[model samples]
Target: MSYDLVIRNGIVVDGTGARRYRADVAVADGKVADIGKVTEGARRTIDADGLVVAPGFVDPHTHYDAQICWDGAVTPSSWHGVTSVVMGNCGVGIAPCRPAAREIAMRDLVSVEGIPFDVLNKGITWDWETFPQFMDAAAARRPSLNLAFIAPLTPFRHYVMGEASMERAADAEETAKIAALIAEAVDVGALGFSSTTLNQHMGFEGKPLACRNASREELKAYANVLKARGKGAIEIALTRQVGVLEEDQCELLDFLLDESGRPVTFIALFDRDDIPEAVRNTLRLAAPMIAKGARPQTSPLPLTREVNMDNPFSFAAFPSWKRVFADTSKAAQKAVYADPAFRNQFREDLKNPTGFSNWGRVVVHAVRNPALKHLEDKSIAQIGQEQGKDGVDAFLDTVLADNLDCELTMASWNTREDRMRELLNNKAILMALGDGGAHVDMLCDSGYPTYLLGTWVREKEAITLEEGVRKLTSDPADLFGLKDRGRLAKGAPADIAIFDPARIGSNNHGERRYDLPGGAKRIVMPSRGVEYTLVNGAVTWEQGRLTEAKAGKVLRG
Candidate 1:
């Protein structure tokens, strides 16, 4: 028999939480046509030799909305066996905007997701204004991997209300216009709608994100389309500290889920050492809700963000720190640390008790000032003790000494083994929330699938290989309703990642690469042991290089 492609002699972890077995996977016309002993000669054959072949991971959360227009493979994500990705996440994206509103939409993406504003301006073609048109653009791009998107609330608000999007609640007419957009979006194959209440997402003017101004009434107005259609999901970021939720946040969360009548996933429920009660609070709130049919989202792999001192707006998570940095020049922003009164207020905010939760573990990597070289690779807590100061003062002083170019990096902090196991083992909590492609300068969680398998399954023994594969593949695929892509069974789409189980993790600290349009830099880390990645039975990447393959589809539900 003849086939389009074939993989011979590999261990198949079929991504269904089943026992692994030795099999040969054959592909014909982009679907897994056969398994077991495949004696047929194929047009292309991959000798897996001694690797594990699993379904390519379906990333249910990412923000590759704008990047896909310029860099189609979606990079580092496709490099890590992420054959399918759901973008336009976190309520911030570029679409459904008129030409006059384009600048603010671009600014919203730049400010909220860290894509450079110049890069966005030069990179995006702005060929489309509406959600369907945006999807068509991606489809026309014919990226090497499958892509889907959620209609974000931020752009919808911007498209309708413009600058006033943040000034007031939506009036009835605006609500109806927004709902019509949402209906058109889902009707044209968007995965769902995404909104965020996270305070950290600021606009270019440093005000709360436009989505923050979205009233629950308007959201329901839009979400009712998803409910009425009996499809799509809701992605949101709620107000919380680790596991703990404010009373109103919980009410709104339950309201969003109940009213939508579709799966609702909230952003980033983490387990923090500083807030031991945090994870418990979240589980308590979600448990009863999950029992009654609500799905919360979590990431099994921890996150690392490489932030520099000059523009370390990450500290704005602290209220007082945010107030201090409000609308300042770089010099003025740095001066806020020098002012004793502002310093006092900033320190007071450090008592957020739950703030950051991992600053003590932050290591000062490289500093722009040669004089501060001695602090390299030392933890902030250690540097603080040596300087006879607290972590806050030590950090601020170091930033000042380096003239704010210090690479004060936050390494992977939240994924404690026990905590991750608890979250991953929870069937209801989908294994997602990797802010891939969006936080490019600070994070590179796009390599999360390989990290989960190589580290958690192989190195740490926190979970079985089958379990990790299931969580990475079928769990997220089922969550987002991509039934065709997540299993290595016959008749399934031939999206697969082949790797040696022992050597499949990326480096602990990724190096920066200036690959974005306009030579803007982003944190890019390549993974190890992803020997071959096939999208729709076509080899897109192999042996550390990308192939000229574009067989990916823009999947619609």
Candidate 2:
């Protein structure tokens, strides 16, 4: 019998934490038909000698909701061997929105996620309003990678309670409506629900995030739908508030676990030297919850920042910058940054070390300023020493010179090596949270899969190659309930990657590209050693080049 495709003579990892073996895998009708020595004839064959063939990587967190409308391949992620992705994380998606609220929703994404407004405006068709309609539209496009979605709480809350959802707890009626909408979305194939309470997420108008003010009661109401359905997980991003509020976060996780009887994954668990014990304490607290049968996971990577002065989202922590950059035109932003009076006001605000501004560590990263371009690799402090100017003054001058287009990357203060190792080895933590399609200008974390393999497995030898592949592939699939993919098993979908483990590495250094629609620029990092990526029995990417085969599908719960 003839097969649709076959991959032969490769070291198969299988993504099950199993030892590697040399074998051949055959696919028919988009599912794995056989695995072993397949001498049978096939329509197509991939010679995988000297390469490690494993299950395709599953990215559990991404914000490709708007990008998928026009870009089926979801580049950069696809480039790094991610054959499947879960979008609409952090409670910011582009469905279930009123026609008037479309721009409003886009504004939140632009401010909080760093997607350009012009890109969204020109790229998305704005044809669908409800969750199912959006799903169907995405499916009809036939993307190059499988896509799943979650019912974003911010849009649901905003749709039900209007602008009040941005700052206040929803009333009883609004809560009930939100619950119903969530249930409907799940029924129509939304994988689950997600919300964010981090201080970093703000609206375009510089207000609190839409989901930040959600009451416990309201969130519980939303979780009840998942409980009734007997499936789906709850994704949350909350800060560590001590005392009574500490109990609140734990209680929320408990309630969701109890109510949904399913997994609950938190956004991030970072390592901070100042708060040396925070990561340990949080994990220690979560250990018992997991022992009692809960799923508590955190982002595998540290919380890294990419800052661009031209992007409003870069200064999302600063209220003044958010308000100033909200204007769509670059001319308006240039006018504001160039004005001497406005510069004085910004400097004064920078002097005040409020929660809204992070001025001290704002190093100059990228600059079109001819005077500053030579200082690219130098930190603000280093530049200050060379120029005999204050670091803040040098930063401000660069920003003004570039008219706020000067990009800067301020490393997160949390860089404890010990804590990173502990968190990386945690049994309860799932390795994920690569915000791929969003934050285009400021970040390019889509290369996390390659980085994990290269950094942890090869260079550092922190984890074995087998274990690292398991985290990138099977672990996420099992948690998210993708039955037909994620493992190199018979009858599973033949979404696979071929890479040289020794040479796999990430090249993300906060570079900009003008590849998006409307000439909108964003950050991207191309990976090395990913030789071939197959999706649904088709070769979609090979050797850093994409094929025209659009074998991807819209995945459902």
Candidate 3:
């Protein structure tokens, strides 16, 4: 029988942690029909002579909920050979929203995820009002790559409790209704539900996100929904300090594992320079929990971001910084930055020491006023020392001079290569949390799949190519129970990535793209060495360009 497509003469990794071998892959009817000696012709053929054929990377963490309403291809992630992505992470999404609460949801994404509000206002189609409808609407879009969803808890809580969701824990009646919504979503197709308690995850009006207000009883009720179904996983953003899991955070993980009886993947386990031993300590603490399916997500890339003064997301963890979000107007922000009292408070807040307090690592990336061009690329600490001023004062003064149009570089933690290797190689640790569709303006970590393949597997040799492929593929697929995906074998769905391993990686910095709705600016990292990407047997991305095919499907649990 003839096949639909044939990939000839390539090194096949197959994505099961197996050794590579030269083979041919054949696809038919959107599934892999054969994996060896495909001599018969097909509708299309790709000569992948020097490429590594592997299962398309599965990104288990993202915030493409709103972006999907506009950009069906999912951009940079698609460019990097990722055939599938799981969005609605951090419990911040644009679903289960009422018509009146539309602005509230958009503002929550703006505050929590660094997406521009105007972009959301112009882009969101708002075709659905419930979780299942949202899933159906996403499917109807027919994106270029496969899309899976997690029912974000914030929108559900907000739907049931309205404005009160952000203020207090839900009452029993409210909790029951929210749980019912989640249950209905899971029954239809949601991989699971996600929520967050990170202090940095402030929502509308700078309040702790709606999920942060959840009491233990309320959370248990939500988890019981998954426990009863026995078919979904839980993703959460825990409140940890300086990359170290505090006692309370550890207890929360244990509690979730006990309550859910399923996999509980938490956001972010990064290395911290201020607390150098934080990673090791957290890994040691997490060893026992690993057996109980507690996976902490980390990234292979360092934490570098371009933070604009208008949206200083890197500093949102500080209590003093909340005032910046209180009034978003340019004039109001300029006044706040110029206030001596505000500067003093910020200085005092730095003494407590979170990640962004390291002025030495913060540099002046760009300036609107050419007169201040000399300040570009100088660390805030260095500039402060040169001017004989405090670092906070120097930093704020520089931005104030530019009328808050200055962009600063935040190169915070996760720089230690030794610590990163340990995290990547750890079986319990999943190399994810790419945060692709969110933070569009701040950074584009969606290029992480290529970064992992090019850096860790090829250059550093931290893990073998086989293990790297498995981590990016089956591990995440199994975590979310994505059936018939994350492998390049007969009978599996033909979502694949073909790339030259020798040259696969993304640049450290992203260039600005004016492609968002209303031509809003966002940083995008162009990939290197990804030759082609296929979603369900269709070549969606070929040689750095997206094809016309929208072969994507809304993947459900």
Model 2 bad stretches (over 4 Å): 171-173, 240-245, 292-306, 310-364, 368-373, 384-406, 413-416
Show pairs that collide, candidate 3. Answer: none
Give the TM-score (vs. native) of candidate 3: 0.92
**Worst lDDT 10-window in candidate 2:** 238-247
Better of 1 and 3 by TM-score: 1
Model 3 weakest 10-residue run by lDDT: 238-247
- Give residue 325's lDDT in candidate 1 (0 to 100): 62
Better of 1 and 3 by lDDT: 3
- Expressed as tens digits, the lDDT of each residue in 176-223 for candidate 3 is 999999999999989999998888788999888898899999999999
Candidate with best lDDT: 3
Q: Each prediction's TM-score against the native?
A: 0.94, 0.87, 0.92
Give the per-residue Cα lDDT of candidate 2 at 557: 88
TM-score-superior candidate, 1 or 2? 1
For residues 1-557, write the lDDT of model 2, one tens digit per residue: 89998888989999998999999988899888999999898999889888899999999888999999888989889988899999888888788889989888989898778788899999988878888888999988989999999888999988888888887999898899999999999987788899987777887587777888898789888888988987787787755421012555776677768777778777566554444576667766666566645554444444446775545554444545654757857778767666767656666665643322333445566678686678676677777677687655666666667777776776553345556667677767778768888878767778889988887788877777888888888888777778777899998888999998878878535467898998887888788899999899888998889999899988888
Candidate 1, superposed: residue stretches over 4 Å from native: 319-348, 357-359, 385-389, 412-415
